[model samples]
Target: MTVVAEAPTFLWLEITGRCQLACGHCYADSSPLGDHGTMSAADWRAVIDAAAELGVGMVQLIGGEPTLHPGLAGLVGHALAAGLQVEIYTNLLHVTAALWKVFTLPGVRLATSYTTRPTQPAMRRSRAGRARMPGPARTSPKRSAARYRCVSA
Candidate 1:
């Protein structure tokens, strides 16, 4: 009897191990001093290509914070061009303009985690207040609308 291997429908890529924070609950033990893996842009591109060829329907880009990876935007673009849906898990802390642009692409989605610390008043704010916090919401109304559409779609 012959057996066939099924291709994976989902792929998770921990593109980097670096993060801006050392959260106590971090599963990867990721922190500011964490190791940013040696994979170069070309290497990541190849991996993305392979995943697409393997019939991966969705790819999740994760890390201590994947946004810290310099080639993230390019990687996202490559994955999308290969007809793969991309989901990025970020801390919403270090979103550069280039990354933000790719994130708004049709086949891409952004996800974030929020941990509340009662000791930190800022952390206790409602979801709406947190959404209006400084970093991620610094875009124009049109851009914000685009982001909303991308995220909500």
Candidate 2:
């Protein structure tokens, strides 16, 4: 057999078809009742091992809803323990502060987005003008955003 080389760094996985909301600008077309398929801890362990063996530097665990995965923390911990950099995209609604507490580890990054659509005119203007406006000037301030970066191990 011939030997093959691995890329230095790359995102090897994506759970693109899952999400908690089906918004107008949703890129993945996710919904609450959307397909609930998921990979188990064992499955992720296999993928991690293979990637490690190939010398892949970064291993991203993504999904329709990666936070919804039962093995999320376990898998992240596993990858970090194996010396692979980890990153995830998520809607923070399902992420508890407790969960965030556990995920803070070395070599991990969480990228999240607060998914909110400004329905009203004033709210839209405020949000649209968020770049130039200060925090207090906006109306209908959203507390919990669906997206945020989390570093959980």
Candidate 3:
């Protein structure tokens, strides 16, 4: 007999709506129009701490683009410290060397959408054992074919 595992309950927190790239099919309606809102760092911390106290096991950080949040690293770190497994949905366009260092924390995973160019083979190879949310990029008339490839790959 096979036992099926139950899906864990998780909080999908929206910390900001700011994004450097504005994709055409973004359901959140995020844009580079600079009209995005951000949650205060204190508020974000409070939620993480509360979730820990409530015994929540997972938290998914989302946004127009979560990395655009000024205190993204701090927020993720707080959640990790609180004993929750964290995952993020990212476009992977802005992650720099310093940014990748943020994922060194235990129980953190990234599901990046490479709508244009896929992540470096070396990076994907290293992360093979970890959970990832990967998908092709959405297409629209706004972005050139070449630019879209860059975003989706």
Candidate 4:
């Protein structure tokens, strides 16, 4: 069989590392007291322009939680105007009614993150699923995330 390479269909943009919840397994080490992000709204719009020029058709907003970003709507608008599909990854725990309005556009989706991480062995062994944060210092975030999907789903 012949194999063909496929172009990337989507782009990931980390708008901020700020978040309301401080989970034990957070990849970005994000918390309610998170530091302000460096990029401005103009920077995001510029990036969207570049991504569209590169033929990227979709944009996935990420971070500690993208909803925490003050300029999220402008960023989403830039992507939408650039002819790209927009999706936001977020934990429903922090979404306010005002923030919810930003997601009302066509082809925009909100994926929920409800992952669990147990520090102690007992909690790790919860019937919920096997999250990788349990083992030891050597474990990786990638490994932890692989196991964390069960809760997120």
TM-score of each: 0.72, 0.62, 0.66, 0.70
Show where candidate 3 strays beyond 4 Å. 1-8, 34-38, 114-153
Ranking by TM-score: 1, 4, 3, 2
lDDT (Cα, tens digit) per residue for candidate 1, span 1-153: 999999999999999888887543455646676676998889889999999999999999999789888878888889999999999999888577877788899999998877545534544254533453334644344223322211211
Residue-level error in angstroms, candidate 3, position 148:
13
Using lDDT as the measure, the top candidate is 1
Ranking by lDDT: 1, 4, 3, 2
lDDT of 3 by residue, 1-153 (tens): 999875446888887776666444455545454333555788889989888887789999988688777788888999999999999888776686766888767788997764333544433334321212133523345545332112332
Candidate 4, superposed: residue stretches over 4 Å from native: 1-7, 116-153
Query: In model 3, how large is the Cα lDDT of residue 128?
Result: 28
Write down the RMSD of all candidates, one decimal each.
12.7, 10.5, 8.9, 6.8
List candidate 2 stretches off by more than 4 Å: 1-8, 15-17, 36-38, 114-153
Please give the RMSD of candidate 1 to the true structure.
12.7
Residue by residue across 13-119, what tens digits does model 2's lDDT show? 65445566544234443555455457556776888877877788887766666777666778888887878998877766668775686567778788776523454
Q: Report the lDDT of model 4 for residue 23.
A: 51
User: Which candidate do you rate higher for lDDT, 3 or 4?
Assistant: 4
Candidate 4 to native Cα RMSD, angstroms: 6.8
Model 1, residue 119: C-alpha shift (Å): 12
